[model samples]
Target: MTALTLIRHATILLELAGQTFLVDPMLDDARSHDAVEGTSNPTRWPLVGLPTGAAEVVASATAVLITHTHVDHLDDTAIAFLRDRSVPVFCQPFDVAELTERGLPDVRPVDEVTHWRGVAIRRTGGQHGTGAQADLMGPVSGWLLTHGGQQVYVAGDTVWCDEVAAVLDVNQPQVVVVNAGEARMVTGDPITMGADDVFATCRYPGRRQVIAVHLEALNHCGLTRAELACDAAAAGLEVTIPRDGERVSLFQG
Candidate 1:
């Protein structure tokens, strides 16, 4: 059995095989303009508050997985909170040097299939966008976690691409968690998975469940949980749009 909880935008808490894994924690209340540009009114930006028992949840985390070094994913508040902790921070090889530069302790570079406690983890390359957009965003990756005979794919901030689909085909995950909010700037199309892309990803074969996050937390991400759920249902996909503190469990033999 594995328990997966949504802590906030792109933040997840997973308890599998007697270990806890946290992903992309943004616990601060402050909105970041440097990361998401063209936002004049900070108050207008949608904010997803931290979970009710976030501190307790994080304190129990045995390991942390970071998809990227973006401010929203690894903010000052989150960094300070994890700095003193003893858990290992798993991230891409490209991010290891950057994390070390930030003086983050116990930061480990994940380059291939590995295990944290008893959970099997596979890291694969991910594209933030196409062409120039991807180059500007730098290297990003997604995680495939298998524990208790169940596979779950956590698609970090990425647009629809062949790599993502290939992961689905290879891993055949039972559950897929996507960072889908159709995030965009005034100048370009969405940089993250739009509703249509989310539908396509979730509709893939062998995906028993799908969870959507990274919505309504920042100014650039315009989609809401309700809208995502509606779109998923309209597309005949079974999906769950969990609130910040919501928990959804999966049992496997």
Candidate 2:
């Protein structure tokens, strides 16, 4: 059985096959940072407040997995919290130096596959955007975990691209976690998964269940949960969009 807790935005607590994985910990109050150059620059971002048991959730994390160095994904508060604990931090090779420089001494850069507690943690390439836009978005990564006869794919802040298709084709994760907020800048198209991207991922071959996160917390995100649900229904996908502090499991009865 797997327990997935959607803390807020991109932060997720995944407990699968007795191993607990914390993916992208953005631990702090809403509006903690300034808005990006483009996008809805509200006086404060994260329109909503922090989840109920945020501190406890962070404390319960067995291991931390970071996909990128974006502030929204790895905030100062999370870094402080993680530093106090003795858990191992897994991230892409590029982010190893930055995180280690940030005082996280136990950071481990995962190039290909790493083993932890009998689970296989693998790294995959991602296209944060297309063409020149991708360059601007910087380096990002997706993660795949195989355990307990199940494969889970955590698609980081990326759009629908060949890299994503390759991950799906090669890994064929049964449970797919997508950052679906349709987040866009004031200038270009959405940088995150939009309705079309969500539909495409849900319809991908061999994907049994899809979980969508990274919505409603930030001002830049234009897609709402209701809107994504409508689009998923239209695409015939029964996706799970958990709210803040909500938990959804992948175990079948």
Candidate 3:
């Protein structure tokens, strides 16, 4: 049995093929920092607290996977936590230098197919947004983890675009993890997956499971689980909406 636990926002604990990975950990407590400079909702960060046992989850992880270096995804608190451990961190090439400069122990760039602890891993491409917004958001990466007969794709911080479609077409993963918070800035469009994007991804022609996360913890993230669930159902898409601290499992036959 493989399990994915939604700890909060973009942080996830994925236990697959007898190995554990902690993805994009933001373990800071509520109101830890100022909100994005210009976002309409300028309240202090993390509208909610870190889930119980969040520290334990960090300590138990066999490795760390980071999609990007945004504060909401990889905060100072999480960096400190990782600095104290001896775990390896897998991330996109762009972030390798930054993480290493931050004093993380073993920061490995996922430039190609790599195997760690019996699992096959591939780094996938994604655009944070289009045009100017994309420039501001910078580069991000998704990950494909395959072990045994099951494949899981973690589609990190991307909107609906041709790259995402290509990933779906080429990988055909059994499970797709989506960031569906619809986070936006004060002047630009949404920077992350909204209900529309999530609905579209889930409607792809397959029986795969969609795990919708990255919702409701931050002030700028306007999308809610109830809202996405309603919209997804209307669009004939099935999604697993896990609350903060909820755990869900996938089995490989």
Candidate 4:
């Protein structure tokens, strides 16, 4: 069985491929990080408090999967916590050197398809935003996790573009989780899935589960949970927006 528990922000405790994979852990107390400069809201990041203890969040995690090394995704506190544990840390090839330097002993890079244990982890492309903003944000990745005839796609920090469409068309994953918040910088467009993009994803011509995350925690993420829920209802579409620390099943087999 594959399931996901949203710890906070983009921090997801994913039970997949027969292991409990801690994905993009930003394990910090609320308002620990400074607010993004020039963002619309100058509020300190992680607006809400953690739903549970941070230790409880990492207790059962057998492995770690990082979409990127961005601070919001992997904070300094998480680094300290991970530095103590020697679990397998999976990431894109671009991040191997950095993670290794951070005292992570087992930094495994998933270049395209990596077979760990018995499951397959496929690294997929993502664009943080369009044109210059995307370039500035550098390279990020999505993931395709397959095992036991079940597939779960985690669309990390990306706007709806060819890369996302390709994943939907080709992989045909049973559960698709997109990082939606319409998170924006001062000048550019949203760096993550906005309302329209998420609606497009849900309305995609297929019977797949669409779950939205990466919302409400950060200051830059303008999309609120209530707003997204209202929009989803108005559009008559289905999208699972799990609360912080809430667990939801994405795929089961």
> What does each candidate score in C-alpha RMSD?
2.2, 1.4, 1.3, 1.3
lDDT of 3 at 117: 86
Worst 10 residues of 4 by lDDT: 244-253
- The residue-by-residue lDDT of candidate 1 on 130-219, one tens digit each, is 778778878888888987677888989898789888988887887888898887766656678889888888766654677788887887
Tens digits of per-residue lDDT for model 3 on 1-253? 6999999998999999888899999988899988877788878988898777556868989999999999988988888888989999999988988999999999999897799988988998887877799888898998999997789999999998887888788878889999988988887778889888887788776657889999988888899999988987787777999998898987533
User: Per-residue lDDT tens digits of candidate 2, residues 110-226?
Assistant: 999999998999998887767777789899998999986788889999988888888888878778889998888777777899889988887777646788999998878889999
In candidate 4 the C-alpha lDDT for residue 215 amounts to: 94
What are the per-residue Cα lDDT tens digits for candidate 4 across 35-80? 8876878899789887887777777788888999999888888888
lDDT of each: 0.79, 0.85, 0.88, 0.88
User: How far out, in Å, is residue 33 in model 4?
Assistant: 1.4
Q: Which pairs clash inside model 3?
A: none
**How many Å off is the CA of 51 in candidate 3?**
1.4
- If scored against the real structure, what TM-score would every candidate get? 0.92, 0.96, 0.96, 0.96
Instruction: Give the lDDT of residue 69 in candidate 3.
Output: 95
